[model samples]
Target: MEADPRWIETPDDGELADRLRQGGEAVRAELKKVIIGQDDVVEQVLTSLFAGGNSLIVGVPGLAKTLLIQTLSEVLDLSFNRIQFTPDLMPSDITGTDIIQEDPDTGQRKLVFMKGPLFANIVLADEINRTPPKTQSALLEAMEEKQVTIQGRTYGLSAPFFVLATQNPIELEGTYPLPEAQLDRFMFQINIDYLPEDEELEVIQRTTTVAGEPPQAILSAEAIAGFQHLVRKVPISESVARYAVQLARRTRPGRDDAPDYVRQYVGYGASVRAAQYLVLGGKARALLRGEVNVSFDDVRSLCAPVFRHRILTNFHAESERVTTDDLVKQLLDDVKPPKSGM
Candidate 1:
């Protein structure tokens, strides 16, 4: 990862923290114009954006996953591209390809590289699981290296590139599941569900009328980048860091730190990336709550998304209807709280 030049001279800690909170509030206000009551999903997206990480949104169809990303692009004033991943999709379709073209003046043939939709500032990978692993790997390089290499040449993506991939969980047939490697690249796997009764009613009322209002743009791409830099400056206590690590390590089966329930059910634990995301995501969560310091609550709340995809359950666990979410909750409950003096 390239060093952020904005960090050369750190701004006043207090003032910069306040700016991050204000920016987050502005983003939320803009998204509310179209999105109804998915505050948790919205928060996770905002947190990932500020933490400079990608998100995988899994939900049933028609839950506004695409709309949520579109609204985010408008709010942040970033170039948004949506790619509909299908079974027949190819890697070149997303990473672009070299095409032979005739020069207008000389009438000479030259290979021109046409950029794909992945070059945009914000990418909505719609139905990502519909595509095979080969096509999915195209995004892996971009997500991890923040660059694309084609034909023995590398093209750096725009600064602050974010991929918000959506996958349908209800369908299994004719779908290619994402590999663990690709899945681990995502900072958070957010589960978006249907709206509540009142929220659904509100959505009905709003969409029923033809006069549905469009959201106005709030922050520019540069401004969003600035806010992301600010998130990195949030201070995390030593205890929080250790807690984050322990939380990740304890998910493994038969570990000393693992709860009895976790040891019996979990087949594998989260990777170190989960611990890193826990700290960074907790900091972002704190910033969202208008705090300069990370708190245990931030880490606790982030456990579900951070561990859901990382943990693998055993067949016996699955037979018992045990979910990774349940294991994460149990781990959080089992971990002792920080000392009162600290």
Candidate 2:
């Protein structure tokens, strides 16, 4: 992967961090022109993108989840594609399919592969939960390997490929629940809450008025890809990395360091991927703040989005109206970071 021609190493940490911070501010300013106010949601999405990871956005309808993704696609100068996942959707519909085609003059037939919407740089898997497990499984390979295989033939996707999926939280009657394994593939499960009163009024006022022009592109596809690689190079202290791992470990019910609430409420804890994403996300967050070194605060701020969907809460907690977010906050309170040094 490092040898890929599209990959770029950061020449200067301070200069790159400053550029990233400036770019982030510009992106946010442009996003505000379209989106009313989901600052945290937008930031998390950008963080995951810079970290070269996928995101699963869960929210109620009419919250502009789709619009947010579309706007992001426009601002990043990425090839955009939106797949409306339905019950009857097939795997071939997403990953493309091979079809027979005849030569124009020779009358000889050969198979031709037609690319699907998933081939784009930014793919919006809208209402992803509406599709069955079989169709949903199609994204697993592309999301993990950045490639798809059909009939034992493989095709590489575009650079900086990202899958930003949305799910309706309130309506689950006809929707198929995403498998735990598939859910874990996402780096962050961002919960988009309703807008505040003032923001909602701004939304209404803006919609009622004439539509403004879309935001201009902030970064080219190659630049975005380069930034993704650069984000990985951000320095992280051993103590901060250890703090991330310790936080993930305490979520397990069987671990000796597990908190009392975790054993009582959690049926299963997060996987090692949780720890990995925590550090990666912290690195990205640090970059957007013009800092090259990830701090413990960066990891702590991302815990809810990184671990909320990964950790499984038991029926006892469900009956008690306890949420995974609450459990994660409790875990944060229970686990303290290394005080002085590594």
Candidate 3:
């Protein structure tokens, strides 16, 4: 990857850039200990982390979606908590509730706020769709605001907090599809698939044998925060930033510039947050690959993951068996970048 000519000169910029690249590679190397494939999945998830955004992982069973996320927390050496969302789960369960407590000396009855699983640095909401919207929304505030309100009191979550949620797409028996508003909160809806034949065989062989050593932690919570702060310093040309905006804008159904397919199949287009994430994700991705500047290719490569969940599809698309991914793909093809920088 070529560093952008517009890159701002900073002291030890190259050294820090190398550290970021090596740190990313280190995480991937550690994941290889148990996880066999899905390099893209790992990359996207890590990008979201660097961008300070949450992700929704979709996959069928036995794909190691949960395992991958759990391994990530270990590799980062961050505090980890896993919540198995179920149909009967309560909102208070995910965000702890206030309970009555009596003091031994004064005999005074008071309510003590108990913290729940959502307070950790890295939270894995496994099978997020399994819970009702009420419970699912309990996490929405924390994901967005980085704090949970209980009994009218707001509690701050530790910095560098990330919610990596997983959903089993095949089973819809008791699943409550996330609301469109909540869906937009996630930076990317990552789809993980079964491994290749050789990778599958390797997984079986590895699992059948004696358990191996766990992945060693590479970056600490402080180091991750440092990278996150550094990501914001990466710059993109105005043309490229406009290209990212146009890419999100074209997803709208009514706009004259929207493609015929989008007008026909899409009910609503992505919000401005889509563009913001596109740019932010691009910066993080650039740094992850050891590049010092954002490129057009960086924004284009993230279109699917960023737009798929933001664009709301209509009945026409569903009836024709068209997916949101199809809409995003068409958006990328039909929307031409600016002749110069875009």
Candidate 4:
């Protein structure tokens, strides 16, 4: 492992960047002990975490999406709660509800708030699409505001709150597609594919044999929060910032600079949130690589995940077998980054 460059032995230097690289490597190593492959998925999920954003993991069953989130929660040393979303799951069940309570002496009844599963540092919303829109909307506030409002009272969630949700891509029989508004709230729509043949064999061998020890905690919630703050402090040049904005803007079908493919396939362009995540994710990615500044490469690397869910594909694109991912690639190729800083 390459030693981090930012950790100078000095009292005044906080060494936040060095800590981020070390913590990131340690977490990845710990995750590798359990997870066989899907390194890209792991990196993207961690990028979202360090960027202080939520993720929507889409994959088929048996892809270990749930296990990935659980392992991440353990390594990060954060409180983990998994809410298995179902058709019958109600909003109150997710947010929490007040119940009638009786006093023994006074024989008086009063409503007491019962905390639900959303009050953890890391929340795994398993099968998110299995639940109805009403229940899914319950997570909106918790994800965006980092707090839940109940009965006109707001209960702040624990610091370093992250919602890593999983959804089955092949099964839509009884699933409700996430609304655009709710999907936009997620920072990345990560797609987990099948493992390579050798990696799959390794996974099977490990599973058939006796289970090994679980990954130990690597970082605390406080540390994660601090790193998230540090990520925001990482600087990006004006040229890189402009490239990120241009990439996001070109995704809109009606934009003057929109590509021909985008105009034909996309119904609407990516929102401002997409650009925000691109920059934030770039900052996190730069920090993870032990780089001092965000680069255009960092922004380009995250374009697919950041815009995959935000870009809406029209019927023409679907008929032509053109996915949003394809359109994003074309847009990136079409939009050239500025030669120098603006």
Candidate 5:
């Protein structure tokens, strides 16, 4: 499918970009009615949605991780399903099972496939780490391929399918750490923190005093799919593209171009996917800001989300309290943009 040509530079470019910006802002406002704070978290989630990628939200329990996914489905007017991962959960539990039943017309018994909760448009894999590796692997096919094979038959999921998986950062007992392979499927592993003092107070007041209804549907599934398509129409300059690649490459250790801190503290660097997401995310951000083309600021703002999941730190770095966030910040500070009018 081709992107909308109207998004390119034209006489009505300013007005059209403004409309797209308002559309995004409207979605955020609708979400805020139910979600209290975490505007940054909401934006990142929205960006992933518009970028057509899955998100892995990591936060302590009671941070509204499930609620956030639920609210997003409501606002987007998409089908939402939640699967609570447990130790005894099996692969069939997530990907569906085959049941033997007699045919309606014939006396012969045949096996029929029963679809699982993963068939929905938006799936919330709540406490994903609680499940064993075998059970978790069931989602790998669905997440990456957007389809599940059951009983030798594959069923394709609905369009705009997104998996919002959540994990408890504090819990370790009875939890299976996600393998690196599955982790790579996630576009962004966002860390959701506790709400601010004032935001917590507001949340209590809003939910307690009034009859807090769910958020109103701001955009239909079709509209959301359309917006995702529109994001691709946003242009990205070559310079900004090169900057994204350079930032991702600098994460590697023992490279001639590697910064001193990266070689000292970094164990592993971001993969090529990091650079791809950086540009795609930059396009979405540019569209959000009423711009047809991406700028340096757009790429810079998205550095954290793009590289956070890709960079791996060592024991020494962890002991020094250095995090992926710190590495990303250093990259942004060290990388200089090309000067204009030079």
Candidate 6:
């Protein structure tokens, strides 16, 4: 298999950096056992994990989105849970609830907190958009705070908790689109497209040939948490950070720095969180590839996944058949990085 383009040679620092890079390579190696292609999607998913954030995977059905996430969790050795979200799915169903159970010896009853699927280290929220907002809101607390509150009591989730949510973009009927607030919590809006004809043929051949073997675990939960900290420590020069911030700020239609396309096509621009994720995701990307520090290219490379969902297009753009990705691409072309090198 061809290596990911971003994993070029670069000097790494410390034992942790070396481990992070090796771990990444090992993961890709293992994932190839069953997965046919989608290297970019896999990279973004790993970047989100290393950055200690969640991701929303958008794709058409039969793309193996669920299988990809399930395989990832297995290879990472994290506890995995899959929740099939529907309109009737309740908050308590996801977050668990306090149930009154009687003690056999004492004959006493009290509310006991029962852990739900959200308690796992890695949660696959399948068809997340199919659920109502009220039920979806249950994840907000756990996703942001790493804890769930039930019956006036909050319980902390296990460390290295990551949610990989998948939604079928083509299936909008009877679906409750995720609210902006919930969408913002996600670190990336990963878009998965059709694989190459060759790869698709290989996928067909493999599935028809034999029962596939599963990927081996590469990193433990504690190690993953440690690598997450290491990613945060990946330094970036202020100029590069400013460039990322400016890029995100320019997405806003009301901002002075926003380009004419943004003003005409977009209803709203990205938020400060967009800038934050750019830096964070860039840092993780840099670390994975053995880059010593974050770069302007790192920030730019993540623009589509980081800003696409955050930037909301207006009616004019929709009518004109323009997408947020189109606007972001134009924005990238117009924006330039600082002259100074780190």
Top candidate on lDDT is 2
Poorest 10 consecutive residues by lDDT, candidate 4: 1-10
Stretches > 4 Å off in candidate 5: 1-20
lDDT of 4: 0.88
Per lDDT, what order, best first? Answer: 2, 6, 3, 4, 1, 5
TM-score of each: 0.94, 0.96, 0.94, 0.94, 0.91, 0.95
Candidate 6's C-alpha runs over 4 A off are 1-13
lDDT of 4 by residue, 73-109 (tens): 8887788899999999998898899999999999999
Return whichever of 3 and 4 wins on TM-score.
4
Model 1 scores a C-alpha lDDT of: 0.86
Task: Report the lDDT tens digits of candidate 3 across residue range 84-182.
Answer: 999999988988888899999999999898889998999999999999989988899999899999878899999899999998888989789999889
All models: lDDT? 0.86, 0.90, 0.89, 0.88, 0.84, 0.89
Candidate 5 lDDT (Cα, 0 to 1): 0.84
Residue 243 lDDT, candidate 2, scale 0-100: 95
Q: Which of 1 and 3 is the better model by TM-score?
A: 1
User: Which residue pairs clash in candidate 6?
Assistant: none
Note the residue pairs that clash in candidate 1.
none
Q: Cα lDDT for residue 84, model 5?
A: 93
Backbone-clash count (model 1): 0
